[model samples]
Target: MKTRTKSEMNKIRDIAEDYYIRLGKKGRDIADMLGVTEQTIIAWKKGRDGERTWDERKRDMELTPLKIRELILQEAHKTLSGQKSELDADRLAKLMAAYDRLSKKTNPRTVMDVFMMFDNWMTDEEPDLVVKFTEYHRRFLFYIIERES
Candidate 1:
């Protein structure tokens, strides 16, 4: 296995912790999947053996998911704008998967509703058409966000 930097390790830990919360995965299961010891997973979770204080670790954990999304979008924009020959497809895909997994609760309706509130945003005359559009968006998002393994 390749060695991971502290930042990378923390990101994985955050994802695993979130998985544990959302899917009822045990720390041992997460550790086994990641090829880490249960003790290490516990340490990371408890902040008992980590270099940073609990608050700092918590803050980083909280921001990691958002950061992953930002990085993926930024890199995609860079690629699309011809600023780069090619983006890291593997990294970008992993980042997107991670973001989608962690952001499963993100409501597509909230966004569509906000846009609909604006005048002339969605000019569909039929109410059923609007409902169908909203449902399509919601299903589209769900299709992209892979369930936790």
Candidate 2:
């Protein structure tokens, strides 16, 4: 049997914590939305929960819309901290809803994940459609990924 260390458990909760932070309009709201116990949220945040439990499959093979919306906001937050662009609240919310509706049972890997899997999907696997996204403007996109991750 494999021994799970404290550090390992902390790491598990950490995934939930960081992603949860990225997930919410407000941190508390996310706790409600994820339907996870509040203790779980705090434990995850404190890096103490070894058994981080909840659905982590991301719906299916594609990125769930909720996750995607979160990513877009994250991207916007990172890429437009002081730039000319901005995401409107109403539009953002609507997009978030759309994302949720579409990705209820799907979680997209990353744009990087898509790119990495391109050849396999093209030759061996057949997806309904192929998707490609250029960096928001190339320069900042990389920075956004770096700063956030």
Candidate 3:
């Protein structure tokens, strides 16, 4: 494809807006169709501010939730540098295991299955079960979820 001119970018923005209103597709779909990445679509969608050049176009986008997760890990690594605390150790090990499993393309432990299991377990609320689980995270997750629902 030829390098996008201002008019071409405006056209892309209009089409992208239409795609969003029609089906709420992420910019990624438009990018894929246009033979570019989602990021380029995002930038082009943010038109130049009274200028004709790409430099005036939007950049330095917000951190997505996934990227925010990485930032959180980085902050945690920096802050948890002490000899150790139980909370720090457990979280650290869990993160390391996740990173290793994922980077190696191994069968990473799935959280959705665990979510489902918790979901099923929470559906039953026998008085005995509630009292037994009162001090546990399962109780808190279930309580909060039920309240939100």
The whole-model lDDT of each prediction reads 0.66, 0.52, 0.56
Candidates sorted by lDDT, descending order? 1, 3, 2
- Order of models, best TM-score first: 1, 3, 2
1 versus 3: better TM-score goes to: 1
Error of 1 at 19 (Å): 1.7
Global lDDT of model 3:
0.56
Span of 10 residues, lowest total lDDT, candidate 3: 53-62
- Model 2 misplacement above 4 A: 1-15, 23-25, 49-127, 131-149
Model 2 error, position 132 (Å): 11
Of 1 and 2, the candidate ahead on TM-score is 1
lDDT of 3 by residue, 1-149 (tens): 57888887767776775565434567788777766678876676564576442322212223333564575566566666653343465676686666655455312113334554664677584546644544564565556566546
Candidate 1, 1-149: lDDT as tens digits: 79999998878877776655444577899898877788877776665554664446456655655676777898988877778735576777776787887687654434544645632345545555666676776666566454321
Give the per-residue lDDT digits (tens) of candidate 2, residues 24-141. 3344555576555567665554432463333342223236454677776874675457654356656666776776666553223354445545635654555433332233324434
RMSD of each: 16.1, 14.5, 16.0
- Scored by Cα lDDT, where does model 2 land? 0.52
lDDT at 36 for candidate 1? Answer: 78
Most lDDT-accurate candidate: 1
**In model 3, which residue pairs have backbone atoms overlapping below 3 Å?**
none
User: Each model's TM-score?
Assistant: 0.33, 0.25, 0.28
